[model samples]
Target: MRRAISVGRDQLMSVGVCFGKFTKSGKFKLHITALDYLAQYAKFKLWIKPNGEMQFLYGNHIAKAHVGRISEDVPEHQGIVIFSMADVPLGFGVTARSTVDIRKLQPTDIVVFHQADVGEYLREQDTLF
Candidate 1:
């Protein structure tokens, strides 16, 4: 059995939702992210049918992505890409395409996404230089 990891509220910053087909299965599905208040922490949840297609309840809202990362240096070109687990782009769903640096994130924000089991892989302090 795999051990459950502890996640800190500091690591969760923003939320993102996406829909796409897994490369191996070629069926549609949804991906959700719960970001930490600092916008530097993230947790991901993926929901898909055995065949890879999303359940009917998802509707035409096929794909989405949200920025949970708060950085003094936001990317000049921000956008979302539909990709496989390998991080290969299947297609483009939406794009922010511009940089917007918001105020530093706080620790009480809550983001809602599809329900899926999330495993904590890394702690926020571990990523610090």
Candidate 2:
């Protein structure tokens, strides 16, 4: 995928598999495949407990208590890829609080705000190409 993307970057311009697109403000809103790809390379990630995996797939935000591990130095409002403890890419979201700030948060406090998830494929199958 990397080779394909890099090779066609200049010539293709608007064709090929899209990972995601940069917003006007320069934030890269990740697509599911992009999230999965970045999960192995980027530090902005969260591995949730099993109990929360289903909820997250259903488009619910993650709570502090449900988080099993968080990558270091994640800032608040940063886009992050969500994963199950077994390392499956489930979705993506924005952090509600920084890694440091989470220390003072309650168990029920919102951690990651859901943006997209695998369940959306099932829920929106009719609209999906």
Give the CA lDDT, 0 to 100, for residue 33 in model 2.
45
Q: List ranges where model 2 is wrong by over 4 Å.
A: 1-15, 20-30
State TM-scores per candidate: 0.19, 0.75
Please provide, for model 2 over 9-73, each residue's C-alpha lDDT reduced to its tens digit, 9 standing for 90 to 100: 56754545557668899997655546656667766989999999998998899999999999999
lDDT of 1 by residue, 1-129 (tens): 022135455875433332322556786443323222212221222222222222213322222233322223334333233223433222222222222322332322211222221221122223221
Ten-residue segment with the worst summed lDDT in candidate 1? 111-120
Please give the lDDT score at residue 10 for candidate 2: 64
Tell me how candidate 1 scores on lDDT.
0.27
